[model samples]
Target: MDLSSELSEFLRTRRARLKPQDVGLPEFGRHRRVPGLRREELAQLAGVSVAYYTRLEQGNGKNVSMEVLDSIARALRLSDTERAHLTHLAKPTVKKRQRAAAARPQKVRPGLAHLLEAMETVPAFVLGRRGDILAWNRMSRALFGDFDSWEPHERNMARMIFLDPNSRDLYPEWECKAVEVVSVLRLYAGMNPDDQELLSLVGELSVRSEEFRSLWAAHTVTDKGHGSKRVRHPLVGEMTLAYESLKVSGDDPDLMLVTYHAEPGSASADALRLLAQWGVDEPAKPADVPE
Candidate 1:
């Protein structure tokens, strides 16, 4: 992916989403060619020269200062994630040498795997940067179905959400879930533009799923954190579960440990207990086991 082009398109899309009135600019009754604030208007708001801002938008501002970037971010009314993405695009840290030094396949630490196993009632899983399910607990299998059944390359959450037919039936709010997956992926893409696997995943999804393509084009970026999702599990039926996403400490900053829980004494909680019991009675297929 061309950083310059990505930066230019990201800025253009963000600029196009805003309106003159949004930034307290009065409508001048002039026929506007662009949908959002004009380059001059944005420049005025950001306290920069129109020429400089234009050059930045055109991907020609090589020596862009942090102060200028901040001003532009403010002018665009960008969110925290969007601002971070802008900074990354303006000055990416990953170089050709860094990209060439391919990362080894991620594995769950024994301690973390043991920790996950101990959480018998909680559905937990560790996800790699590209949403690959690196490791998951027994309850996680009960909640989200058998990850071991999937082909190694097909273990990505984004891929499953878009390509797996079962996912549509599993999540009642499929659209919302799908959007979140795309936004999170977009965030990762901004951070690691040169990741060949990630690029390939995006390429495949963009070609195969119209919905994914549309969301990807929107350039929305989001950080994964605590959230609630209502899912309809085939075995357990419908349940609203709260989930927390934490970064795995140690060498792998890109790996995330996600755990789902329900309110104490709630029906969802009971369902989880039942799911755990089911897992105990009939052991889930191990990750190494093929379908």
Candidate 2:
């Protein structure tokens, strides 16, 4: 993605989302060509000169200061995720060598993998920065279906949300889930605009799914932390699971360890226990005999 163009579009869209009343400005009986706060109005609110703010909005503010950016972010009422995205776009640190190195496959640490395995009853998985399912436990497989069954390239949550038929049926509120998935990816894209894999994934999804295309164009961003999700597993019927997304520390700061749990003594908890039993009872696939 062209950093300048992305920055410009992001600013424009964010600016267009706010109205005069949103920022406590009076509406005069004058004709306005553009929607939301005018450039001069925004500049005034942000305590910046119109000319400087115009240059920043036009993607010419390569040397934009953080204080000014912060002021603009507050003026536009950007969320934490959106503010971070703005900072990334305004001051990108994409070196060709770093971009090339990031293309390598990310692996879950042995300790994390062991920890996941130890939580036999909890549905847990480690996700890479790009939402790829790097590693998952047996409960995770039982809860979300077997990621091992899919090709490596097809193991992305965003891709599954838009492209997989099973995912649509799995989530009760599929549209909302889809939007959240896209929002998380939007955050990743902003931070690493030069990542070829990320760009390719976005491009492929945009071409394949019209829904994805429209949402991507919206430029909405969000941080994926703790949340509750309802899913209808074929084996367990319907269950609402509360999930937590914890960022892995140390070497893999971008990796997230996600785990799901149901309220104690609830039907969802019973369903999860039953699902675990089913997993234990199910026979393993027979190995193929070599000819």
Candidate 3:
């Protein structure tokens, strides 16, 4: 992930999504060459000189101020997440880029692993950055296939979603699920562009899947911690599950606890119960969910 190229492409894509009238600017001509607002139009909207904005767009963000970035963000009508991504792309951490290729492994806490085991009737996974499943419980295995049998790199959600054929059958709205996964990965990339593992995963997926390639170029960003998903499970058929993704607050802020539960009275809940072996074969708590 080249910082300069990424910043240029991000700003270019964002600007290409907006029109003059979309931001209250009057439509001046019908023969516009570009799809969206011109560079001068954006500069005017941000109250900056065209030359300065052009320089920033070309990825020379040195000495740029947060105030100017915020003004540009407003002009582009960026969401909070997108704004944060913009800031990150403009001012990446120099040390992370200069650091060694080896990134420290992300770990899940022992207590959180116990909680995942206790969620016998619920499908739970302790995911690290880039959607790597560091640990998971039996219910999760029953619901989403046996993660224990997979190699460490194969346990990643993004990899499974895009490269695995079974994943297409798992999600009824596969495109929606794929977009969400890709968006989350991009958010991570924005903050940590120099993550070697993440880049390697992205490169592999891009080469293997056409869908992943297209979605990766879109540059969507989201930070929502909770959502609902409809999964087409092989054993239980199609069911809707609401999920919460909570970040661990202490030393491992990168680890996220993802838990999935069905509505109490819905058919999905009954399906989940069946997957848990009618509450009979639940396993004892574990010391930690191993990666």
Candidate 4:
């Protein structure tokens, strides 16, 4: 892939998403020629010349300083992730290196696995960059209702969400879940551009799921954390749970730890307790928790 073209497209797309009113600019009450602020307008706001801004957007200027980048970022109102992406794109080393490491499927850290064993009351799991269910605690197995019998290739979360009918039944708010999936995937793509596994997963989803394809085209990226999810399980019926997606430090690209919780004394919390009991009482199904 052409890095220069990618950089240009990303900046241009982000710019196109903003309106004059979005940045507190005066609206002339006339038919606008562009959907967002023009190059000249943004340049003026950022204290740069239109020609210089145009050159940077065209990828012709490689020696852009951090001060200019920060100025542009401020003008565009970039979030932390977007700001990082811009810096990554502008850095010479990212373009100089060709050996972008592919993402390895995450393995449950032994300490994390032991921790999971200890947390019998809640469901927790490790998800790799491609959203593969790499490892989970016993209660998580019961909560997700996925038998552990799938081959390595079928273990990805995105695949299960799009291809598995069970996922549709499990998540009551399927559309919201779908958007979350796409948003997280977008985060991964920006963070790990050369991950072959990630690229493969994206290709497969775009081919098989129209919803996935549409969302991918929109180029919406988000940081995933501290979200509420509604899940419908056969054993527990429906429960709304708050989830936290935490990054495990020192891990390579795309590995994370996610856990779900409900308030004590709530119906959802009760359902989770029931799930823990089920995990203890039921026979250990290795097939239910595939390797």
Candidate 5:
């Protein structure tokens, strides 16, 4: 990917999402040509010259500083994920002679596996940075369908969302979920341009799925943090459950713990109870279950 172009387009797209009134700038008139904040207005907010901001948007700011990047992020009212993305793009790594490397999928941590195994009531899974399903509890396998049975490197959520028709039907709000996947993938691309596995994943999606291609070009970025989602599982019906994504400290960049829970006595909670019943007779062993 072209870092300069990616940086430039991303900044422009973000800036275009804010208006003068949206950022507390007084509304002048409806004669605005662009969609969001003008270059001069954003420059004033970031404490930079209009010409400099223009150059940056045009992909010519090679000596950009972190201070200025933060200022721009502030001016744009960027989220935490967006701020970190700006920092990553501003400091593109110097090219190395070694070929770009794919992330080597790591084994599930023993302690985490034990924890997931114990949490039989809640569906949970461990994910790596690139959206790989490293491990999942039995309930999670039942919740997300049969992904845990797939090999780690092959069980990417983004790929499934785009390529698998079953997944598209399973997610009630599939479009929203698809955008979130692309946004997170965009962040990963900016932060780790040398991840050949990720690049290949992107390439494969772009070639195979038009939805993926379109969203990828939008250049959005986000973190997979806490959120609630609605899923339309064929067996359990529709459910709205809250989920938390916690990063697992490890040598690998792609590692996090995700757990889901529904409010007690709620319909969703009842559905989860039913889902857990499938494994009631099976061994409560971690290794036996994929998710």
Candidate 6:
């Protein structure tokens, strides 16, 4: 991954989205060469010299202070997540010696799989670096398509959303889901800027899915939090499920424990019960949560 190029593009996209009047500056003429504020205009807003801001935007952020980044972030009207992304991009997180560390696949901690098993009624997953489905419970198999059946390389949420046809049926609002997945993936990419595997995934997705390519160009950054998702199950039909993503305490800080539920007495809740019973009727499958 080219950190400098990523940094430049992220800043450019953010800058292009704004206009002179959008940031309280008066628009003097009807037309301009660029879509958003010019370098001079952004530099003025950031209280910096044109030369310095240009250099920073060109991806030469060495020795750039947090105060300068904060000022530029404010000028761009960036959100908290975007602000963090900017910081990560401007300041490279991984050193040259640490690039080799990216090769190691993240491992889930001991007994985390059991937690997923304990929540039999809810579909749960233990996801590691770059949305890898490191572990999942039997209920998850019932709710989500069988992860156990997929190859390790195929067990990724982002890949499934775009490349897997089953995902189209699962997500009613597939476009929205794709954007969110890409945004989360972008945030991770910004942090682990040199993760070869992640870059490879991005390259493969970009080559295969036009939607993924477009979303990747947008450079959206978002954090995963509690949210509601509506999925259509082949057996039970459409259901709105509430999901919570909790960052678990483990060796891998990025490991997430994601679980889904539905409101009590609602049809969606009943659908979950039926799925659970169906899971029982079928032959018991091994809960292959990685050790």
Query: Who wins the lDDT comparison?
Result: 6
TM-score of each: 0.93, 0.91, 0.92, 0.85, 0.89, 0.93
Question: What are the runs in model 5 whose C-alpha is more than 4 Å off?
Answer: 26-31, 93-102, 148-153, 283-291
- Deviation in angstroms for 36 in model 4? 2.6
- Predictions in order: lDDT: 0.86, 0.86, 0.85, 0.75, 0.82, 0.88
Candidate 5 lDDT over 1-291, as tens digits, reads: 777888799889998999898888996887988889989999999999999999888877589998998899999999998988877777776355322334443677677898888898888888775787777777887888776466655688897899888887788899999999999889888877777777889999999999999999888899899989998877788899999999887655467888999988999999988888875776543433324
Q: Would you list the clashing residue pairs of candidate 3? A: none
Model 6 lDDT per residue over 1-291, tens place: 777888899999999999998999998889899989998999999999999999988989999999999999999999999999999899876776556556777776557766766777888888878888888878889888988788989999999999998999999999999999999999989988778899899999999999999999999999988899999999998999999999998566778999999999999999989988885855434335364
Return whichever of 2 and 4 wins on TM-score: 2
RMSD of each: 2.5, 3.7, 2.5, 3.2, 3.1, 1.9
Model 4 C-alpha lDDT per residue in residues 54-147, reported as the tens digit of each score: 9888865488889999999899898887787777666535432333444333456566666666777778877766677777777788888554
Q: Give the Å shift of residue 17 in candidate 5.
A: 1.1
Alpha-carbon error at 283 in model 4, in Å? 5.3
User: Where does candidate 6 stray beyond 4 Å?
Assistant: 95-101, 283-291
- The number of residue pairs in model 6 that clash at the backbone is 0
- Write down the lDDT that model 3 would get: 0.85
Write the residue-wise lDDT of candidate 3 on 139-171 in tens digits: 888778778678777989998999889998999
Error of 3 at 125 (Å): 0.3
lDDT of 4 at 137: 70
lDDT of 2 by residue, 105-206 (tens): 777767777788778788898888789888888888888877878888888899889999889889999999999999899888877887888999999999
lDDT of 1 at 44: 98
lDDT of 1: 0.86
